[model samples]
Target: MFVAAIVGLLVSMLFALVRAFLGPTIYDTILSVNVFGTKTVLLIAVFGFLMGRPDFLDIALVYALINFVGVVAVARLAQSLLRDKVAMLIACVCDSQWDC
Candidate 1:
């Protein structure tokens, strides 16, 4: 059963890779990448368990936290970029004297 879980995780990782490569938007790509990261963490944890190494779980936990933070950072950056674009458009419209 463990082996099957590993195989399933590997397949999911491959699918995530495809999504990351073919995503139409930056957000989609970022989300795919995040999913890939999560799969990696799971893989590591499973391998550690197979090897009877208890310390590996700690590493996996750290990796999961880091992955979450990375995803959040990417999302924040995209949001900021969108806000900047909207602000620029508003400024351009307001500065035009034709409306005054």
Candidate 2:
């Protein structure tokens, strides 16, 4: 059963990887990557449990937290950059229409 769980996780990870690569938008790819990261954490935890190392679960928890925080940070950074680009485009349009 544990082996089956690991295999399922690996298969899901593969699917996530495919989605990330084929995503139509940056956000979709980022989401897929986040899902892949989560599966990786689960895989680690399961493997640790199979090996009888509870300490590895602690590592997995840390990895999961880092992955979540990293994804949020990247998403926020992308949003800000996109916003800045849109703001610049608006400014350019305004400048062309008026003396601002």
Candidate 3:
């Protein structure tokens, strides 16, 4: 049963990877990456149990934290860039009307 579950998780991870690569929007790609990260954590936990090494769960937890922080950072960066672009466009549009 564990083997089957592991295989299923692996398959889902593969699909997530594919979506991450082919997603049309930034949010879609980010969401796929997050899914992939979560699947990885699950895989690590299950594989650790299969190997009789409980420490692997700790490692998985750390990896999960890293993944969460990374995704947040990427999202914030993307949002800031988008906000800046919108601000610049507004400024440009208003400048032409002497609105400062």
The superposed Cα distance between candidate 2 and the true structure at residue 93, in angstroms, equals 4.8
| Local error of candidate 1 at residue 7 (angstroms) | 0.4
TM-score of each: 0.84, 0.83, 0.82
Q: Give the C-alpha miss distance for residue 50 in model 1, angstroms.
A: 1.7
Give a tens-digit lDDT track for model 1, residues 1-100.
Answer: 7788899999999999999999998878988999999999999999888788979999999999999899889989999999999999998888895676
Candidate 3, position 99, lDDT: 66
Candidate 2 stretches greater than 4 Å from native: 92-100
Best by TM-score: 1
| Cα lDDT computed for each candidate against the true fold | 0.92, 0.91, 0.92
Native-structure RMSD, model 1: 2.3
Q: At residue 45, what lDDT does model 2 achieve?
A: 92
